[model samples]
Target: MQVEYQAPLQRLNTFGIAARARCLVRVRSEDDVRALLRQPGWDWQHTFILGGGSNIVLAGDVQRTVLKVEIPGRRLLREDERGWLVEAGAGERWHDFVVWTLQQGWPGLENLALIPGTVGAAPVQNIGAYGVELQDRFHSLDAIDLETGETFTLHHEHCAFGYRDSVFKHDRPGARGMGLRGRALITRVRFWLPRRWRPELSYQDLQRKVAETGIQQPSPWQVLEWVCAIRRAKLPDPAVLGNAGSFFKNPTVTAEQCADIIGRDPRVVHYPMPDGSVKLAAGWLIDACGWRGKTVGRAGVYEKQALVLVNRGGPQDPCSGGEVMTLARLIQTSVYERFGIRLEPEPVCVG
Candidate 1:
């Protein structure tokens, strides 16, 4: 509960943006959070909940008191006839947790390996990779109500999980509103790992690995290894090149719209969703608009993956969040002008 004034945040964010929090508090436990909430004249609305800082862009120094979550723990809460229930503190690194589960013979999370950020941030974005989303394995979560200073729990339905979205990403005024965006702080997350597990290779990248290796029946650990390798080759390492992984969500279009786009451009990359909608590769769209390997100010699109935007200036002269947003806006405008589809940024921007 120690409050540090004017805390340096350059190293805190994966983007390596030079910024500082006006006031910062590192919450290592639920007691720390409760103590902060009980402070005299404290205002939760004037606070910002920061996790690993992986899915955020800081335009400038944050004015709000930043609550840096660092709660850490991992355990198998229950091993029932149904499945194994595992829980992790909000602050635990997501990739590390995934690997830990596999090491413990819990294989449900293998497909989501190598994603940046912490367990708490997973539900906020409904993070998905290699054909498995967080909600697919989520059991429940414990969180604190920022306004009430009380703790509560939310199951998958209460979370309102969607593709890269959840109630935590929204803001609603009334208590009954579905959105919980700025009103709650997650402290712990639990996952239900099935007793029987199967490898998910629906994602094209994993399929390619199967083809190259000629291994039809891959184990969960094997799938994890393949996912890590594919991500390493495609995505730029944040430690080397500052980036927020995929910069945009794959836009879903109607079958008719897909046909129209294909008729115009024969090589458009797309896949059919189970719901019958067509999911277009946002990277393909950006490349079609000629944005790959392009730069704007100190921000640039990654040469390896068009979906990722990187800070070309490096740590010494890192790109500001404004530069990233500017480039994002330019890409969005061009994609919309050419393809009649708007590109939505994935990261939350703050200043």
Candidate 2:
């Protein structure tokens, strides 16, 4: 375990906002996490877990101990006639894990290529792209209870995963559920991947790319490359420019509500949600509001993708000077004005 006080979090988070943490600890092992949790004088209310920090935004200084989970390892635990059970540490970089699986000829994660964040955070959000979700291949995960310092194994059912949500998101505290709000910290994740290839080309971009390339069935590597290309084109690279891939999740509304919104704006793009609802494209809504490439202070919507909010360099005040929150509010207000649907932010905000 590595510990530091008054740590600068600007370099830690992908958003490039410079916020100071009261204290920070990097746990490289499950034991480290257990020991840290067992320590006295650590306020449970003022503690939080962080992974790659790719899906978070720092609103101001964090008056808490930011636990950076860095435990790292990967192993093939079991294989059967159906598929292989691959286990990875929660702290492993998501893209690296996908590359490792692809290099091993494992199928299932190719569609999730180039997604930013850690493996631990994947299950929390049921991260999905190119028509594949983490829950589809998730086997189980190990997490530690913050209060008791006890470790528990959670299966798919226990996770209670939904579209961009899980037990970690909606479950009530102390309510017979794996509530994500400051209750448990994910340590390791297991994925069940198939040996045989079953390529998914349902996403419009994937379908268009395959058709344009004239490939009947592309290999997993080819699929990964194409997805990477698409993501690179659509989402701003956090390394080059500070920004989360997508600030807001696509809004899912009832069929009747969808019809009403489309009637108001015919150009609205809609996807069929799994639960008989309609998922409206947030980018389309934002672009329709003429928010693309619009700048406010140092924050602005990305030129190519309206879903992304970029922190254009300007004044140095990390908390107030940046325009991210302003732009996000603008998007939310405009979308709400144009359509009745509310846009929920995907990134966790810390202060």
**How does model 2 fare in lDDT?**
0.85
Q: lDDT per residue, candidate 1, 1-351, as tens digits?
A: 778999989888888889999999999999999899889988988999999999999999999999999999999999987789999999999999999998998889988999999999999999999899999999999999888888999998899999899999989757688788877999999999999887888888888999999999899889989999999999999999998999999999999999999999989999999899999999999999999999999999999999999999867789999999999999999999999998888999999
Regions more than 4 Å wrong, model 2: 314-322
Alpha carbon deviation, residue 235, candidate 2 (Å):
1.0
TM-score of each: 0.98, 0.96
**RMSD over all Cα atoms, model 2:** 1.7
**C-alpha lDDT of candidate 1 relative to the true structure:** 0.93
Residue range with the least summed lDDT across 10 consecutive positions in model 2: 314-323
Residue pair clashes in candidate 2: 168-180
Measured over all alpha carbons after superposition, the RMSD of each candidate to the real structure, in angstroms, is 0.9, 1.7
lDDT of each: 0.93, 0.85
Q: What's the distance in Å from true for residue 254, model 1?
A: 0.7
